[model samples]
Target chain A: MLLPWEYGVRNLARRPLRTMLTLAALSTVILLVFVVVGFIRGLEKSLSISGDRDVVLVYSVNSEENIENSAIAARTPALLAASVEGTQQRFGVTHVSPEMYLGTRVNTDENNGGLGLVRGVTTGAPLVRRSVKLIDGKWPSSGEVIVGQLAAAKLGYDKQDLAIGKQVVFENKTWEIVGQFAAGGAACESEIWCNLADLQTATKRQDLTVVALLLEPGSSTAEIELFCKERTDLELRALGETDYYQSLQQHYKPVRILAWLVVLLVSGAGVFAGLNMMYGAVAGRVREIATLQAIGYRRRAILLSIVQEGVLLAAAASLIAGAIALVLMNGLAIRFTMGAFTLRIDSVAVLFGCGIGLLLGVLGALPPAIKALRAKVAVSLKAV
Target chain B: MKTIANLSLVTAIVVLIGCKPSESKNENTKSSEPTGKQYLVASEPDDSTPVGEARKGAKDGDAVTLVGHIGGSTKPFVEGIAAFTIVDPKVAYCPPEEGCPTPWDYCCTQNEVKENIATVKIVNERGKTVSEDARQLLGVKELSLVVVQGTAKRDEQGNLSVMAQKVYVKQ
Candidate 1:
């Protein structure tokens, strides 16, 4: 005799439309969960990965903790050059970059313009940010520009538009896109970089916004804080780059919470649809279920069989959803006011989607299976 | 066997929708030279003190006239307030002869333009933010020269900014 599980599988074959409908619904829900969770994970990773523990940022006091609004005097860098005792030095040059940031509009053509943030960086910038790598062409010089792979996306430029020798117009001047770089999927990949002096002259703001310093292995923020304290003229605050990013992550806690709330709302609707399908399947198969009971199958075995079919359908949907998410959403750059971040569909997101699918299958199947089994065997068998 | 076929069909439909093309062909076009006439045309001449000179340690309550260009290409609107930056031409980090490639900001060069900038807050005689006129100035591009007459005041950081009564954009 065929086993009860095989019988359950056979029942699914008899009602192909019902089975297909249920599976499609479950898969759609699975995809929604994957996307929501993936978005949160990508934003967090983008911010956290941008910082280096050995590096520290110095910004002017009372700038509201916004690097864009902060300004340090022209002589600040020169003052801090030799004052900080434990600063890391490479090739006899101090490992410090006095950087500038500008929020602006970049346009490849009149129809393709968008908001972009550009960074004016020194030669030591790459040293301070070890994760950044020049993937093509050469480092920017003078009016030349080098864009990050994702930053180009935010500016409405595609892979070909950002190719070397292309020109993007901004601030009434043409900047040649000479190179492209990436900083390990960090937020820095949302900005274009050029020689520091060139950007300052363009915006006419000669003051450096912030200075990043690489610290010696044994050194800590205390040493740098002390140096800032001793100088009365340079009232600056020093924070580890990692700690700074952590604080920013905290600031965006509300946004992440909002994302989770959306996931719950959308997933709740999916669950209700799934429950309806399970109930309909059990009611339609009442006679089949009673026949199994009359033929010496235990009530518990009948319930298990019903549940097995639901679980199998859900599992199949989850697998397909995970595969689609991985191929489509992974590494897709999403833009916000601050910058752009790449979506990551890693194992965690995939597992989360599958887990929800399994939970829905069990919860949705239990109620209907128990109800179908509660009906009198004589009445169920006689009705057919 | 039929159950397997139905399941495969559902999966195929889901995959197709999820993997649909997101961007259009026209969205990824190449860079072309800037074209067309100026969007904002100036009808009158503007006269005021240079930004570099006005930023000098003027008395906190001193009234002054200032002339400079908006600094960056990004929307310089001060959120709820109606104010923006006015920068002296000489203060731009790039030398006038070198000419900056992007005029909205001068971040690509060194830190010599530190004292060559001033914020222009649009205010009425009552000193309240002029929300109406401020909204009208949103179309002004960065690096567009303009003139302002207002009171000079020092901010918490000792930077001088103007509380403007009038602003004249140099088209």
Candidate 2:
């Protein structure tokens, strides 16, 4: 027969201080699991969602994967709009955006500055980047710029520093923050955007970095690539937006692997710590266990009660960790080399964290319970 | 009741961890082979022009034979098409000791790469590039020397591409 459920539940209350210490230790470990898993998920989601299958990116062939280093003739966009067919058009204007992308130091004050991604774009950018939406203020004009929602985190500044009407210094010019935009959690959310003409004037650059084109339904990206091949004098390369971000995902695979390794190492350490605590907890209760066995209770029943006590503590710890992770870590902005993305404490992360917690409970209890039960009941009962 | 509830929750989590979402496989849309006469030739064409000279001199619809190595970029071959970029043999590739992963790209000479590379495509009667991989058809890989006989098609901006009729791969 099994031990009564209340027997195990009440046992956790018997040693309140020891139980609390175990709970705290288990909670800390699980919380770390939540954090690392959340980072992996957030980075993956940010890259995956940033790509649009219908968009084709056109940049200089020499630039390879780094679009910021790309330089193309300023007239390339006009040439593409005229030469390329099947591009999305509305009211006689083609969906082609010529953009200038660069990375430079951005300063909110004299002392606070960091490298920030900046983009110079025209009105056509919205047609190609459909995910972007202006949440506040208006489009940037001369001597003004728009900040993405996460641009402050990317530049290592407070949100208030990028507020509307505030001034930011970059490219040796001070610009007013005229607007704020969100890109559906894309990498672009870490960039500052301004008028193409103004940025070009500020940076003294005549060439463009890239030209993004939105294709109409039923159109294939092959046509754009064929254009790039035929216009070899232009020295251009064409890639689907989806394929570009997929390459970025491939580039960061090592970082994700390292994060997973951290999760594994942290879990291994937690299991070992759980084993030590469980051994100590079970070792002190030998007399009580022997008394219970002497009163006609089987060894199996005593073992089940000990395991129940462990699982109860673990379940409580998981609850505490889950609460703390959701409140403190969820939607937290983290800066990366590409940009800034928010920590995603989604359902998957919670499930993984809780699974690890329950696993620790079961594995920690079994060996100690089996070892304690191995001793003869008569000898245990006679012990002090 | 509480014990059963906790056990059920644990069991559910275990089951969920075991269950993975199925991956969606992308369907291959390319046909097995191009619909045309054989594009690979058995003999090398005589009086072949270098890629750099051809790019400068060949006019639209002019018959031309050019010889070059099969690489000018990291990805010299276009995906799902019988087309590739060839660089002039005179352009020196990066040495293996230089730690250049893709010497075929000739990364050491960017300006020369721009001036010496010509795109070659095998086209059908309809003037459309074939929907097949060039590597399989030509039996040539990156940095393989080959001779191409085709009609030169020049653009208004002085870019040169060849609609290839035959290709001879050197051993």
Q: Which candidate is the best by TM-score?
A: 2
The superposed Cα distance between candidate 1 and the true structure at residue A201, in angstroms, equals: 0.7
Q: Which ten residues in a row have the lowest lDDT in candidate 2 chain A?
A: A265-274
Cα RMSD for candidates in order = 16.9, 6.3
- Candidate 2's C-alpha runs over 4 A off are A109-111, A291-301, A376-379, A382-384, B1-37, B42-47, B90-101, B109-111, B135-140, B156-158, B169-171
**CAPRI grade of model 1:** incorrect
Which tens-of-lDDT digit does each residue in B92-160 have in candidate 1? 534455554444455653243456667777665688645432434434545667777778986455577
Every candidate's DockQ is: 0.02, 0.26
lDDT of 2 by residue, B1-171 (tens): 243345446655754564443453222122233233387776778899999999888999999998898888777778767888888999998876676667787877878888888889988667778877787666677787889888998878778889887888764
Q: After superposition, how far is residue A16 of candidate 2 from its true place, in Å?
A: 0.7
Which prediction has the highest lDDT against the true structure?
A: 2
Top candidate, metric DockQ? 2
TM-score of 2: 0.88
Off by over 4 Å in 1: A1-3, B1-171
Residue range A1-384, candidate 1, lDDT tens digits: 334567768877788998888888888988999898899999999889988999989887546357788888867777778767778887798888899987887878533567888889989899888889999999999899999988866775566777789887766668998999988888788898988888888878779989999998887665565444323235566778898889889778778877876666556656666667778888888988899888988888877887787788888888888888888878888886668887888888888889888877776677788888889999998765
lDDT of 1 at A377: 91
Instruction: After the best TM-score superposition of candidate 1, give how far the Cα of residue A231 lies from its true spot, in angstroms.
Output: 3.7
